[model samples]
Target chain A: MTGQVRTVDGRVAGRRGQATRQKLLECLSEMLSSSPYRDVKVIDVARMAGTSPATFYQYFPDVEGAVLELAEEMAKEGATLTDLVAGRTWTGKPAWAAAEDLVDGFLSFWRKNDAILRVVDLGAAEGDKRFYKIRMKILNAVTNSLTDSIKELQSKGRVDKTVSPAAIAGSLVAMLAAVAAHQKGFQSWGVKQAELKPNLALLVHLGVTGKKPTK
Target chain B: MTGQVRTVDGRVAGRRGQATRQKLLECLSEMLSSSPYRDVKVIDVARMAGTSPATFYQYFPDVEGAVLELAEEMAKEGATLTDLVAGRTWTGKPAWAAAEDLVDGFLSFWRKNDAILRVVDLGAAEGDKRFYKIRMKILNAVTNSLTDSIKELQSKGRVDKTVSPAAIAGSLVAMLAAVAAHQKGFQSWGVKQAELKPNLALLVHLGVTGKKPTK
Candidate 1:
């Protein structure tokens, strides 16, 4: 569990302080959704939160620091993505359903946190270690579980012996993330959301089971 | 074919002007690699190219405009990616080779143009039409070819009838791109580049053919 939430100046934040910090984060998140990440300023975020810039600085060093906090929170929520794959059977109709549920959950998660995730993605791609670690945290949850599923299938001779479980799982997870991030692009390309989900689920089933789903 | 080179002001660029413009672009590309995209300034690019900011403006309206030019050039090169999937068989052992070649070619191309491609990816994710079009142009080269290949297989009864060719092809291409962009992330996660390619190719083959590769 996270320790006491502390201000940038190292003061332990109480209930009211935490509420204020959360409000600032919520306002910052809104700003990220409406404006380019480069153009988001601390002053604007403070104004939007009905607080002073000094209050913003007390809670965080700068805009990037606040964004990192938001990313960290999202990554924690992303950890629960493991439930979408872990303990799920990858056989017959159930396998197909599992794939569908996983795709649905992953896509929705990305869509909900897209603005912050986009910034995290850019920072990670730009070789920032802090952002990279957070990205890994979010992705590794689903990826590790999927890797286990693939390895289990391979052990039963249902999947190929030569397949690298981690690689396949990682690639599939990345695919899900990429497609989720560009859902609008897919729509513009004429693939509707309803059609996209099934196709994605089918591919996930195919990738994991190495066969077409029994559905 | 592209029309004659011209400046932001609409004047045709002479040989010397073209050289200067190319140099400025090259410097801008270098700046993008070494610094955050948000921090890349026209002044810095001009200084690095040994030109004035006014000169930079004469050629490019702003950093983003110059980046679009870089992305445009990269997209042109990316069109050649079609050759990786076009006319390639999707059956038996050759199918495995086809998949491997596609993975190798795609990964290398992404690595070569990662700095600018990262910016394009971010831009497209943020709903920018120009960047989205460039991204579509690059991915569509392979996705469309792969779609045709899958449809051919479906017609021959090799691939599943229920599969959506465009959806599968687009997802697979997106997987390749996401994997390529985060190659370092995979490395840090303990997946070797040598091991990663074969696994990616396997998924590509499986998604396209609905069966594990013969290899």
Candidate 2:
């Protein structure tokens, strides 16, 4: 159940307070997209929201705290990514489709929250535990499921015993996240966006099933 | 050919000038590792370098410009990555060795310059042309060579024609870069550094040859 929204000082936010809080978040998200994370100030976010710095402080402690909030919200949406892998049978033609659909869903999710994800990435890469935890919350949704799938295959002797499911799954997930984050970078290599998805799917299938897709 | 280093004002940097420029760059690089990229200031670098901000200006325009310098230097070092792929055999045990060597070399390269590469990664993601170009310079070195290798295999009917070589190669390289960038993130998932490498090499070999390595 959703808990009551509370301000930094612990008072529950009313409808007006919640509205302003949401407004500040939206403005902060926009600022992150337009400028570097370090340059994003709480005062600037409040100014963008047409409110006072005092009002910004009422909801969030600072820019990093607000960013953590945004990242947490994105992680909730990232939970839906489990559907991309959960119960998907990685067998024959279905395996190819599973990989394709997973790639499609994951990329779209990343593209939607790329700005906040970028900051989260930077934060995690910089060794910030809070940001790192939020990133793990997101990627683990798909990774854990995929890891389970691989382990299932391994148990059936369908996959190699030497393969570590978690490493492969984590690497594959990292690949998707990296490719999604820099989708434009592929264009310069002459790999068109349309072509990237299936190739990625193929690799995902190979990484998971250790075989070329039947399709 | 290595050209003479010059100050921003067009004077050829002598031994002393070059040393000062190098010192400033070293100091800036240290600052980037210790602090956020956006917070690294010319004044701090100058102070750390035991010079004035005016002297810092004499060598580079600003923090981003100096960062570009550092990235360019790292890109030159990245050129050596070509040895991991260029003119190398990609079949049997050699293929496995190729993949392992690449993973070893690429990871070391990223770890060595990770602080600067993080800025380049952020800049590329944010659509900054200069930063994007530098990032491409570093990745294209290996990606292009790997692409040619895949194309060679495809032409010989040793690989799938349906597979986009550039897409597959770029994705693999992106996987390497991403994995290298978040090497620490993998540890949290219970994948240690030693186990991580061989699994990555396995995926690279799979993506490249469309078969698991003989080794």
Candidate 3:
């Protein structure tokens, strides 16, 4: 559906086209942050953006299309961080330290996009066909990042050989969704990482390095 | 929206109908097990037990009401198992051994009602308000069950103290959702729980007992 949206004004083509779409995307994202996906409509998004419904249709076939596009963009942005974690020179960092940094980078991204991420997290399990596709894309991006890292560690004999990297990767991926559900738990309780992050790091570290967590 | 479903007796009610409505609830439960909640419309449900839409309205206001009624029933049935877990007798079984029996009993129920569970999971998340209420009920049921077991272990000094029992309960609840998501992933791979449940149980054991599973 997003594919059908042609940026209006062929000259709304390059930088201008991108800027216009970005503005529209930005508006829809802002609205989603405060509301559930089903509650918000394309017309509502357009009105919130101070644009015409027709203008919204110019860049998005519907609300889900716009949301999926934004999700894909965020997923890509998330990918760059994964790349950073993967590409980092691991020479000075201990294996555990590297894993900690990767998760921290991931958490910070979630923090920055709290609203959009909240909506996506809430909507991902829904039966919506398009929403599921965008979600799986993001999940793959995260898993692929971890899979490559684990495979590298395995090749170097730095991690366990018995567990499949994909299984470990799946666990690492599952842990994020697990923790993210409680992101709101953070705001409500004001708990610090000294208590939470370390325990979580232990779980992921065990999954990755295949060592028993430090007691 | 569920507060208005007319029953199959073709009688909309106000006809000394309380007993007749009770019969309809029993019929609705039987029908839902064999059909998806989303697919079970008022008319078909009414026809199934020799009733009419008018009589259906006497009990449930609508479809959500029928689903809500059934979900509530399932949770209550599940609580019967919870009562055993919370008992002092322990059935003289090892903890995981007892847990396995409990899990098998619960899962057997799920296996037969896969269609309804799938519908409820999807409908509750998809934008159906009643569905969300049902989902919340299920979460509460799991939390209560775990709370009883955790408190029992804590009193015996079998559970970790550093982690809040609340976190322990929540962590377990979430791993189940992750289990469901993993099962969903398998569907794409042309697989099912036959290939996933044992691994899922291993992960659950890891999460709940804070013991790294050797399996």
Q: Pick the candidate with the highest DockQ.
A: 1
Model 2: CA > 4 A from native:
A1-3, B1-4
Residues B1-215 of candidate 3 have per-residue lDDT tens digits of 43443444454554456566667776777776555343457888788768898767766788766666667666556555454345422223354554454445445555544444554654543445566555556555665666566666667776566655555455445445554544455356343445344434444444445554443
**Residue B50's lDDT in candidate 1:** 95
Model 1, B1-215: lDDT tens digits are 68999988799999999999999999999999999888898999999999999999999888888999999999998999989988999999999999999999999999999999999999999888999999999999899999999999999998778778988889999999999999999998889999999989988988888887777
The TM-score each candidate achieves on chain A is: 0.97, 0.97, 0.76
The estimated TM-scores of all candidates read 0.96, 0.96, 0.66
> Candidate 3's chain A scores what TM-score?
0.76
**Native interface contacts retained, candidate 3:** 0.05
Candidate 3 Cα misplacement greater than 4 A, ranges: A1-5, A8-18, A81-108, A111-130, A145-165, A185-194, B1-136, B144-161, B187-192, B213-215
Q: lDDT score of model 2?
A: 0.93
Compared with the true structure, model 3 gives a TM-score of 0.66
Candidate 3 lDDT, A1-215, residue by residue in tens? 44533564333356665676778888888886666454577788878777788877777767766777888788777666655356643333355566566667666676677656544653444345555665566666766666677788788987656545665566556656555544444333334544555545545555565553443
lDDT of 2 by residue, A12-131 (tens): 989999899999999999998888676788889989999999998888988888999999998998889989999999989999999999999988998899899988999889888998
